[model samples]
Target: MTDKSRKPVRKAVFPVAGLGTRFLPATKAVPKEMLPIVDRPLIQYAVDEAREAGIEQMIFVTGRGKSAIEDHFDISFELEATMRERGKDMSALDGTRLAPGHCAYVRQQEPMGLGHAVWCARDIVGDEPFAVLLPDELMWGKTGCLKQMVDAYQEVGGNFISVLEVPRDEVSSYGVIDPGKADGALTEVVGLVEKPKMEDAPSNKIVSGRYILQPEVMRTLENQGKGAGGEIQLTDAMARMIGTQPFHAVTFEGRRFDCGSKTGFVEATLALALEREDMAAQVRQIAARLLRG
Candidate 1:
């Protein structure tokens, strides 16, 4: 049973341990989470979203060769001094700064899986329902997707995941939800199937990368065995908590870009660039030319 007055989600976990094998040579040295979408790194966007949702502590589950991510969050006095000296706007750095005691990082140590990566931060996230935002999933909306989910979590206290409607045929690519009653954008989730066959899928609604989960899920992952992809699947552990907890899916009222893929990254970059006043005209011209050619 969930605590009727559950602690608000004040912490967020970022599982940034993936090797990003998809981006190849570019990611050979650069952590893929450091890849810039428009002007901000993918990780920054996720962090900004977490901050918007009132996340006071930012926890990162990282692996080898990911020190750049840590450095990215740390304050660089020299850089700030240099920017000040050069008269560059320091406002750009506003969202990147996490107060001294607000950020924490834990090493994943091995390439286990998302569930394992999340479990790595169990200590820091102790006893509180926390948010998990995959940097690879770049979401754009008036209000951050996590913020939207946080609002919903406050209403119907329990574990909640951000979901989106995908094509029926594409259901197998995601963790499909068995939806129950619906109230506005919130849906009661009775079941979850990870990467089910199209015919086996319960609904077209699929879990996105954002989640507000209870700490008990960490205990579930403690003895969880490998599921789909031979990794300790987070969805599998989450599935077990459906009936035990008040699990629900909050449909994201935003555009989500799967920046883990090259195509999605390019689309996100173009889409974001086109939204910027400084770059929109130039981007539109280039896009028009490319389309014409």
Candidate 2:
């Protein structure tokens, strides 16, 4: 099938080059993306999500102190040998290992902004539509959130962003979209504003961490001016793509946690643990007892 006939999303870019200062001591040596929600690191969730969406090539934009992120995906020969000695199943280790060419890594070098980090992958991404997932934003849904948007891209065929309705008063904290029309969960985006005030927001809907962006966005980000934070914001680059490209916001059916925040991190851990059949009962009872105390 041609590029348009088939899904245009064959690649995915993961912007994980952050310093992760919020987590401090633990993150001093360990990248925050390596921090576990329960059993998997934060970046693993984003990788798993992308793989589920049929993403063939996984590109990670990394920075200093992010070597653990690379080592995590590499084969653990010693660990696998130990597991084999104990008769552990190999099926559980399938997706966790990268086979030579399946994954690629590039450095962001400096902490310019999200836009610049994304721009670092332009050469690798080439000229095809790719998905972007922020590891810090943990999204939980029946189906992986990225998978849901990939399913939508098949029908809509343009830049698709995972959108969610945030409270009006809280809109200023996120990049808000100026919605044009709604067809069930998908909303046509006429314009996008970067963290506008509650009253000035185009709509209550805010752009979440999941995105299926066109390759052209990379070109836009290359020369994009600094926005809001005196850094080249990815939202600013995306906003410039309006009219020239088809932009739509997809309302996800999932629970998204800003795990970069302390509260959100704890909540994600608890929620994910509760979803596990093995840990559900014990974790729930402990939580209940703790609440009583």
Every candidate's lDDT:
0.92, 0.88
Listed in order, each prediction's TM-score against the native is 0.97, 0.95
lDDT per residue (tens digit) for residues 214-286 in model 1: 9899999998999867889898899899888889899999899999999999999999999899999999999
Model 2 segments more than 4 A misplaced: 1-7
Cand. 1 TM to true fold: 0.97
What's model 2's lDDT at 101? Answer: 79
Q: By summed lDDT, which 10 consecutive residues of candidate 1 come out lowest?
A: 1-10
lDDT of 2 by residue, 1-293 (tens): 24652346888889989888999988999999989999888888898988888888899999987889889889998999999999988887667886787799999998889999899999998878899999889888889989998888888778888988878999999888889989999899999887788889989998899888888898899778887668888888887888877888889898999999999999999999999999999999999999999
